[model samples]
Target: MTIDESALGFGSGARAVWASDPEKSRGRLHAEETSRTRSEFQRDRDRIIHTTAFRRLKHKTQVFVAHEGDHFRTRLTHTIEVAQIARALARALRIDEDLAEGVALVHDFGHTPFGHTGEDALDELLKDHGGFDHNAQSLRVVTQLERRYAAFDGLNLTWESLEGLVKHNGPLTDESGNGLDGPVPQPILDYCARQDLHIATFASLEAQVAAIADDIAYNTHDIDDGLRSGLLQLEMLEEVPFLCELLREVKDRYPELEQSRMIHEIMRRQITLMVEDVIAVAQAKLAHLKPRNADDIRSAGQAFARFSPDLQDADRSIKSFLYANLYRHPDVMRVREQAAGIVRDLFDAYVRDPSLMGGHWRTGVSGFDEAQICRRVADYLAGMTDNYAVKQHRTLFDRTPDLR
Candidate 1:
């Protein structure tokens, strides 16, 4: 069966451009030519939803650790928010919502446990072996790590989805500007290129939209979390010039707001302003291209610019506050240091010899292999919650449960 062009959201103008693509009619899977229950893009979305990495996000951190509170956002929740914001932007700009949402959902699948802190430790440990990057790890997870299907080792996602994952930022060009354009220098690009799939030309405008949405979500939500944790005061924000101006505007319009309600209102306003900035830039850039199909949209010149200078300064101010007052606070720093120690120790133990690991380590035949053993240890450490990591550290290293 072939794709029903009419079922897609691309309007007549876009449809005219989409119909010209040869691959549009091809089924999602090469093996099952007769099965056509889902469009290629839809299949991408479904595959991600069912993946181990996507499910593991529920245990990963957003800002605070995952187990701090049930109400706190997990990596999974953040991915959902990014997808929601991306889909909204895609709909507004007449791009592919399915592709946008698919990319957003899988963007953080490679993040290690304990958030960025764990990632830093792992990167240092693996520095001699080509280093570790969450983005590249994400590609590895889909392509090799996950062992679900016997028919294929990886998820076997579509070329478009893979491209979106690697080059979501844009095409990689050379310093000379005259050289041929290429995909970004990430490991995912190397893997895809080795397999002979077209490397992502550049991230589609929709992917850029997702990236912006991520920035908006994290910036605003980090502030919200900081304020809620009592590390930042409303009065302090009210005195910070640019943030002061924004807070004043919120107060004038949202009087009587308090707590989470007030914070959500402030975040909503900030996100709306960011979205407006994106819309303005995109409209201006796309005005000349007249792009109507997904390929054209992806290949069009850059659709958005960096944050305005004013916004960038304000963002830096917010980041500074978070770094100095929230992230570096004694309590937070203590936990992060402890997590780093746990990760390092675990890596050392497993990398030296897999036989040292206690539970479940003795089962798998592959456990004796150093690389496989290191990965298993990493997985075990990664599956830990913040408190669990602390407990395990105490249990194994400190020699007492009540030492604290």
Candidate 2:
């Protein structure tokens, strides 16, 4: 098969000057022959979809436990949503759609079971050794943990994909190599030593689109899920003025609409509004910045893809309301506490006896020191789905907390 350049969107004059050119990709950490039929970004997306870690997302929690309700969004569904929005944004911005979609698909691969609760538990357990960051774990997953390839342990994704995965949320360090937010995750720093991801600069415009897509997807879907879970009522949404206006519009348009349809309509409108806002903002920013190429985007010193100021304020308002009324609600917090316990218990159990972990995971772990053992245990636990973690907890301990 020969490379189909035109089919890869390169032939289309629509692609912007700043769009990532797969032909000029920085290349993968491990040298591999180029695909005859696919662009590097397309190959990256396909590799991500076939990973064991990607499949595990089906049973991982988003805002609700995977087993709680079939209707709730799991990590897989959320990733799909993010990918959809990211592709849409990429198309609108005339960037590399495949790279944006791939980044969105793999962004949450590092999340532990039970969402933030499990992450918190792992972070606390590893505080002494070096704290756990899901973002760092995500990089570790694609670069080091996965063992499917013949030559490399991880997926051996392209440099662009790896850069997007690690820095989708933005640069981790400043000019002085100091952490931008806090201490850069040890896993990230360690990986940078071997293969420099240029931790100080922004990722490609493709990655920025993926990052904002995540914000748009989660914000819209969480509210939809909250409504389904009865944790958030239509009336409660009025607390956020932006949402209140949306509610008013929905009611005024379809006064006779049923509850479920009304909720869906509101969600549709919310997603549309946010996505459009992002496109408009990004277009204006791109015009002002006039970036000549993908590298220019990285050095632009500000995010080119984001909500406008008014929408950003609205986004914050919606987030605050969700935090107060849904995330920290008595019922959700109770479940979070129970879920955190399961993670904590599992970590302690594995740390005490590495033999208790799967045979594949325990291989050569006996020679490792305490910190190494803890990290190994953390990695094993981090990969588990909510149901698997619960099952392991049941098998290991006599009593397990009821997540419900």
lDDT of 1 at 308: 61
- The model with the greatest TM-score is 2
List, in order, the clash count of every candidate structure. 1, 0
Name the runs in model 1 displaced over 4 angstroms. 1-35, 171-186, 196-200, 239-242, 292-313, 355-404
Q: Write the per-residue lDDT of candidate 1 for residues 1-404, one digit (tens) a residue.
A: 12233333434334224221325623333354423676666777888999877887887767677556677777888899888887766665656667778889988877876788888898788765545677777777777667678787668777666666766766555334332443343465568555533443555565677777777777777777777777678777764566677788878887887767877777788887766566555655555576666567655555452366567777788777778877787877776766677778767865665555656654584525554555566655654544555565665574422211
Give the lDDT of residue 216 in candidate 2: 92
The predictions' CA RMSDs to the true structure, in order, are 6.0, 4.4
Tens-digit lDDT track for model 2 on 278-384?
A: 88787778777899999999999999888888999999998898899889999999999999999999999999989999958988986899999999999999999
| lDDT (C-alpha) at residue 315 in model 1 | 70
Least well predicted 10-residue stretch by lDDT in candidate 1: 13-22
lDDT of candidate model 2 versus the reference: 0.92
